[model samples]
Target chain A: MTTPAGTWNWLTDPAHWAGEDGIAHRLLEHVVLTAVCLAVACLIALPVALVLGHLGRGGALAVNISNVGRAVPTFAVLVLLLLTPVGRWGEGPTVVALVLFALPPLLTNAYVGVREVDRDTVRAARGTGMSGRQVLLQVELPLALPMILTGVRTAAVQLVATATIAALAGGGGLGRIITAGFNLASTPQVVAGAVLVAALALLVEGVFAAAERLGPPWTRGGAR
Target chain B: MPPDDCLARNEWICGAYLSTRRRILLDATLQHVRITVLAVLIGLLLAVPLALLARRLRPAAGPVLAGTTILYTIPSLAMFSLLLPLYGLSESLVVAGLALYSLTLLVRNILTGLRGVPEETRQAALGLGYGPLRLLLTVELPLALPAAMAGLRVATVSAVSLVTLGAVVGHGGLGNLIYAGMNTYFKAQVLTASVLCVVIAVAADLILLAVQRLITPWTRTERA
Candidate 1:
């Protein structure tokens, strides 16, 4: 933990790269935190958004609430949770915090995607004797797939980045390395951690971008 | 003897604790206000110029804007950790990190606003013998201001929340209070900080709404 001027020496050290406590392990932890948070967020947000989008009456309020959620600081929420009875368990608090952090984009995108579907398509489906549920599943869902995927993409990137804050609350991730590096004034560790996080973000963005491209052509046309 | 001992132990300590909690809330509110203002001002100064450069050079703008998008997605705690050794517990680190976070939103909005300006207006400005600067200031910027301000409003609210991350670096904003409360298991302090952060966010949003109204009188007039 000593503050060495040439801390990059760790880069060539086999021991630092080989153990269970290495870069691979940290990345696994990050991925787990991100995945779990996103899964839970989607579970909560998607259904609510779908229901609201179908109703159309409460969509504005739902979207506004989601917008407010976006404005709230993730770390503040994490810290607040950590100070409570829930904080005694440690890891669960981090998961809850990340879920809350990821919710806005998921909800907003789902709602907007459904809301933005062509009125004619919806009208046509209803005209052809499709029930509301059938229209949602058969027609609107396909049309809104691109936007829904885009929201998931946003949530994925956001959750990955924010999972790092778990380090502040003693939850393990790449953020732990970054925070330790800062505490020890070790530039190489800091650089390595930042680079890993940045690369991960790019990777997620690329994956999602490709998925968005592969979505329905009509939605792509609308996007363009 | 038992009653006297219990009363002596609890009452005085509770009174002192309540007063300290009240003081912490007041300090956090003030600190949060300052951090939001500083971050938004600095972010605007940096983003506007970068956006202008992006528009003028369409080829390079894609990669450059992509880089900022990456920056925006980096976790706040991770970014702060990366900056710690060089900046060393300074306000500059927080301000710079928050500004970097705002780049994606601000640049996107600026580009959108500039692109949205009617083609005819630009042609008319050129026909009037106005140079690039004059045309941009007189015709383009005024037209773009509303959209740009929408981006600014988003950035400002984000910056307000992000400044809390500065708490980990030892800067005493609302985040610091929240983190401290969590670390020490102080529920009152945690609640106070959380409430104050939300209040500041809402208040700042209202102020931005007012500023938007002042700057974009046409929007209000149109509404009327």
Candidate 2:
């Protein structure tokens, strides 16, 4: 039977599989970019959010600031950076924009997670002579694990999706394929690229969902 | 300075760009706003009924929720490509993709809000001879406004941001400028366009927040 459209043909072509602009190379670039951004964003966001939650202070300030940051679209940030000196440095602007894009969900979820830990449980931990660090690590962090994972999941999916926009900055990603398709006026290639991106995003989401479920048994809601 | 001196020199923050390109920017922004607002409104219209359906029929809750979640997982680039065939590179393609993206947030939040209505409150409303529709409209919906508003704010901000991606199709309001600017490495256009997208997203979020607060004054007292 004939293929429904050129989409399948474009995707299955052997020549598209080789060279620097190949699907594999672009996919790798997308993943590496996403991973690096997620790592940096997590490093920056998790500690501050966790610390603030541990100290039981500054929820309003943190959440409000992050919300404003979140409001700024990632696309604008990516494009703005592309015009800067740094944007010329290859992946710098993309990484920065993506990191910024990923920060809000990570920050908000981790903060809310740690803060939402039962107050009595925390007090008891302190009463039992646990240091503030101990309470944060042993009591709050464990309970907040699922929530933090949730933030990670959100950030991961968004990063995978938005990393495609990085192609507009001349950064590598599956999005490059779509943009290239547009340049060539090839609907099939564009559709094919979109399918790959959507698949990757969904895959990342599923991985994170599994990760969330893999949290301590308490995440499943049994333990007190 | 010549009217287009900044464009010639490629300055990042050119007053000349703004003055010379005001009409273009205004049109882009208006398009951006029109698409974003339309997407969110359509999203809410669809999401409310879906949320109500999920709430009304326990068996449907899983599928309805899962479907939106899957939709949300698709990357914006891919979402547009997948939708290209249906909408044929039209503005409606972008609007439809954004609306679909907003569905997960809207349906989930609205459902959560509706579910969160106190059982006693619902029961009391029922006992008062309030018809089902009246109960939903007057009591349940008002009570659900806070959660629903939270989703709306997020959906609106994201829509404002994502509409820029529509530039891939020559329909991405401010995104078109950003896209064109990047191709030419035109500093002023890219920076100006990007900043405008952020400003729009931030302003839209603030407006939604104000609307939420205005409509849900009870939440303020409850907090106090």
Candidate 3:
């Protein structure tokens, strides 16, 4: 098959855009799943990391422990979730899998961001009558904002790419397009689907990068 | 396969399955390691020259890094699908995609490592009559080794995780077993493959950590 022309035709077809399986619909599903997964990951990982970093205790240990999760394939996680009773919940399994997949970077960056803050600055904040909670929320969190944002960005891009696996488990996302292409042996449809996912991933990266650049200058340099 | 017999028996423990599929498990494990190592090495080879070029020419760094970052954001499934039209379910496509995915991490780390060398050290090397090539090979790259190692460790682990996606493209690995198990609703097979993937990733990382320590003993301090 002449995939270039075929892919173009598939992409341009109005028929591909009018139903639950349309590109726009799939794109929305992909984005919504990514957003939900990211939100849940942040809710779970951020507070724990921030507190550990603020307390100046167990930050390294926590980051290292969570980093272990990196080796476990998200596909495996999704499949295992499917095999368990959680499989009955459909979207719940995919969301849980993606959240587990997204945690390490968020936890690591937030912890590092807080731990890497200038000790003198923290001390000065305390000396100026900032309470412990105040020192954490005002001084340390502000200084750690860029890294925290960086973690979010990393997780977001990753979720966009990985959330495709949700389709494999009978959920909906851009991956459904590619898998559908595979089933029909339509190379062009597969290519078009891949292009869509790649484009979305790049867009997410670009947006996060712009956000990083717009961050407070003090936190920017220390983000990595 | 004995999976049918095991299912009939209704006692599908991890140990029971392991004893039955010893040969299949070993082969998949070996293939997984082989692909991961090849991909990481390819990524390192490609990254070094680009990283060096970026380090030498400041203007080129942004574009080079942005390009790789965009590439890195592509979903594993999408990337494999993108290559399918050309490679048609070959391992080469998966390996190429994984290598490409690795460039952003490797190039960034190597550039950071090279840039991290003290300016005075570079000046001193120049004053000592070291040629540009000599300065890089002798002074800068050696100093950059730690960061490069860190990059390699991350790339290797991530590649291990991503290589599982190759199973979707029909390249045999632990992932194929996971996929097969998922299709058949076999808990033991899924658990075994998933655990193996994690074990391989952690083992690869630890081995690289040891190698980094061996190469950079100066970075380690004596215990009291």
Candidate 4:
């Protein structure tokens, strides 16, 4: 029975904006969940990708290993974890699933980023008496920063989208808005919730795209 | 073992769950395959023209690419909710949302593939009496297949994963099982459905990989 006008009305209502289930609260939850997942994923994935990329060997193996789980949808992982003992701890399953989901792209890009550094550049650094560690840090890291950032950009945007599943696990996020609306059979409310999440995701994407494009000189402007 | 034993024990891996739910599982998998295939195919269809337009017109490239990437950043739930008004709570909503999701991967890779076709190759084709349309069909498109297929493979796999989110809309293929089972803590049901989802995704990816190689024999020959 709800119409587009109803959706507008629902969005404009201050009643839905000020309580525990308000947009502000849900937005906070979504941001916190996504940030936590991305931070944890980066800590785990970056070092492995960077190191493997520097060594110039086994980068593919490491990336592929992480990717084996890629075929399994993140939501499925979240549900499986919830069905386990891990679900006993609130928010635990969501975190674990999101972290795992974010790993593959982060690992792939970080590894490829560092590996893409010109071979001759590394060789020149080595011939100049730079240690392997120094070359990795001084030569490879800087050039790879843009590509690594590309990975982060990809992971962050995806995490924002995926983190909405946290709401399904009874954790807080914008997804609760939509699910709650569904329970109430309010299509307008549901559309409003969708709008908020989509706006947030696009905003995140825009910010990261800007960061990647306007980053350091080594940042390739396009075609990553 | 008794059919209900696994259910009674709340096991994570249960043969009984599969045996008992075989028909249900098959239906869910079929729905999942249907949704994923439809979404990816629709995505490919949309991507070709967009990629072509982008390559053909330099000014259009930025917007077309940006638009698709922005679409991608919209979280799956949000995307579905946004489309709720248009398609209601049905498989079409899920398919439309997923098709949008696939566009970023599809468009980017196809564009890359198209651009990857060497200028020299185009010149050769033109020199040999190939007009624009003919040149595109025989020379440009064939060269772009490897990249286009790569994109398709990625889009297809991710679609399988994302389709699980459709459970929220009441049509998430295997996601419906996982979603329902999670509510009552049906461990056997949840695990069985998830494993099937993984299997489908992996199997689809392998098939696509084979297709990519088969179509782009020249790529292999060059590598060899």
Candidate 5:
């Protein structure tokens, strides 16, 4: 509400929503980048965490190492990548940087979720003639589902927000709108861009939260 | 000047980045540290009281948690754009935004730590005629230190990286180096700043870990 008139005007303008530089195009770019990066991050992080959690070995070390990604600025990593050969491929560096940033939450959540499962439950599953693989797939994985989803939710929301940095590296995303607004000194346009990003992040959070509620009753909190 | 030789000549390449602007680097690091520490400290202080209030008032917990969670989900770039109109390129906007971001984590951790204290311990403290204030200070806080400290460690790491993004709002730090480096295609500057950001994060995290260990000695001992 800082510049109520200007911000309102920008939000209502049909031109900002209809063309190549319109909100639709930018929103699609942001969504695609977010989805691609998140999918790749999940692919890389989920299996490692699950296997480690299933094996009950080296999970802590892996989690700790991945936490390093949290400490390193994604923007910094993005810039560094942009200077390397990876930058030559257009959006490659940005995607890699985003994937790296998204890893810690997914890895930590999955590992911790698995580790937190009741030992007796595992033992009981084993007693029921379940093999190690069966115990993991049938018991531990189910129990860990909530935590894993929580991690995914966290990463997804974060990626939606942080993906804005992709624009800084000449990659297409909603961040370009804000930066473009800055270049033109259009505060309302910048504000509008921020609103879109925040709204998208909240939308992602809501979807995951709803998914969590609609999940199997066993995975829900208070089920125990 | 081959890529392989550049990688092998580690010191030589690093030296190129540090050849000039030593003063600028030092100043930027100090600014980065100052901004991060200040934001987190303020967040921690604010979160404790809010958390205590939420614990005491059950009806308030839902709203308080939801509000802070929403605040945390706001994308950094948009948060900046929204804030720019109100705070206008000042340190206050960045600190305020980050402090708000830290609250959800810190408050939840504090609440968890407080709740984790055994009911028997609380009863004993009450039976001893200990006042609420005294019991909280001597009994609850010490027990809660571990959880609170864990929250602090995460917040500090996040704050360090977020401070770099504050450069976008003109609050200069190591992020400014990366920002300028990107604009100029200067690998040396980008590399130096990114590495320093990681180093700061890692060092801060380690120090917090040490502090947590020192403060929670009972955690290391078994209850025979």
Candidate 6:
């Protein structure tokens, strides 16, 4: 199972990352899958959250259901889906699984954020002749943005990290490098892949932190 | 016999499907439950001391805790793959990876719980001539247990879910059922495993809730 001692040399070799069928292609696929999942999850969860918050109903059930969703392993979901007729053993199933993984946090945070807005603020909006939709759009959404963003930030990191598991299902990513290293008993290659994944996670976290800081003060330091 | 029954054959396909899927699911469920419990137990043993150390030494705490957080964010499959070079496809590798993943959440919650103790309570303890060790044991630790337990609850739920990924290494678990189903395209096995995982998560959460109530009666009162 041993490869050459410098097996990791391929990591930085321009040719290994540049052409078709290179690491770059896999990396691009990984990024696209992750992005699509996050986008889809947000689109679906946000409206549900808004409606739940607006009606002041189903909040507990929604949050509890999401907690259950989050508690189910992403890999398990992916594997289960792959067993279905609808799930091909590729990017499609992996992306769908990741979207399900991301949904709970986004929906929970959005719902809680909107619900926590001061009651007086809502009253004032209504008193000013604002329609229900207008009040939600003008007031609650702004107030909830930061909390919602925090959830997004958390989900983004989780999604990127979990996306690597797609490699097991033949959906390639940086994880392919790690798995290949394992098959070959290559420590340096293993180290290289793990380091790259860690670096990506930190970079995303930092970016999200900055984004959060750019928001209003009230939202920035709100209770977790 | 009815015409439909004759056409369909006298054998009960649904009964056969249910029994086979149920057997696989039950076996996998036991394995998943074992792995999750073992990993969480190990994680708690390691994390409690780390949490205490961090609380006592404020300056070095941030970097150490951050390192754990980064480890947590590392993709589980990638981490397992990385370790396979060193440990191979064994239960040790799976448990170790899961334990490391739980460290961040457990440590952060413990620290947060400790820090969240009211300043006046500590001051009162000091005035009563309690030393640092005694004050921590008698006052801070007791007050912080509820919050730390909340963190533990979250960690346990997470660990249970992630252990399913161990199926990739050929370990037996509910995930194994799902993965096997995927490999053979058995929809019944896939659905059975997934539904069982969800049920396990919900049941575990409810148990944790009861434990929290028992340990933190004051919290229960506050909620009520």
- Residues B72-171 of candidate 1: C-alpha lDDT, one tens digit per residue: 8777776776666667778788877787787778888998898899999899999999999999998899899999988988888888888888887777
True-structure lDDT of candidate 2: 0.86
Q: Which stretches of candidate 4 lie over 4 Å from their true place?
A: A1-4, A212-216, A219-223, B1-4
Q: Write the per-residue lDDT of candidate 5 for residues B101-136, one digit (tens) a residue.
A: 787789988988988989999999999999999999
- Indicate which candidate wins on DockQ: 3
Taking all chains together, the TM-score of candidate 6 against the true structure is 0.87
Query: Evaluated on chain B only, what are the TM-scores of all the candidate structures, in order?
Result: 0.87, 0.96, 0.93, 0.96, 0.91, 0.88
Best by lDDT: 3
Looking only at chain A, give the TM-score of model 4 against the true structure: 0.94
Misplaced by over 4 Å in model 5 are A127-131, A222-224, B1-12, B220-224
lDDT by residue (A32-148, candidate 3, tens digit) is 999999999999999999999999889658767666877889999999988888989869899999999899889989999999889999999999999999999999999898888
What C-alpha lDDT do the candidate models reach, one value each?
Answer: 0.79, 0.86, 0.88, 0.87, 0.86, 0.78
- Residue lDDT tens for model 6, A111-186: 9989999999999999999999998899999888887888898889988888888876767777776666656666
Q: After superposition, how far is residue B152 of candidate 5 from its true place, in Å?
A: 0.7
In angstroms and one decimal each, the interface RMSD of every candidate reads: 2.1, 1.7, 0.9, 1.2, 0.9, 2.5
Task: Give me the TM-scores for chain A across all models, comma-separated.
Answer: 0.90, 0.93, 0.95, 0.94, 0.95, 0.89
Model 3 ranges off by over 4 Å = A211-222, B1-12, B221-224
TM-score of chain A of 6: 0.89
Candidate 4 chain A: minimum summed lDDT over ten consecutive residues — where? Answer: A215-224
Native contacts recovered by candidate 6, as a share?
Answer: 0.64
Model 5 residue B121 lDDT? 98
Ranked candidates, highest lDDT first:
3, 4, 2, 5, 1, 6
Better of 1 and 5 by DockQ: 5
Candidate 5, A1-224: lDDT as tens digits: 45878888898999889887899999999999999999999999998998898888887586786677778888888888888888899889999999998998888888888888999998899899999888888899888988888888889999999999888777888999998998888898988899899999999988987877887877665211
lDDT of 3 by residue, B1-224 (tens): 45456545634365667887899999999989888988888999999999999998989999999888778888989988888877898888888888888877899999989989999999999999999999988999999999999999989998998888888777848988988888889888888898999999999999999999898888886432
By TM-score rank, best first, the candidates go: 4, 3, 2, 5, 1, 6
Regions of candidate 1 where Cα sits further than 4 Å from its true position: A1-8, A18-20, A214-224, B1-18, B21-27
lDDT accuracy of residue B17 in candidate 6: 59
Task: Output the lDDT of residue B153, model 5.
Answer: 91
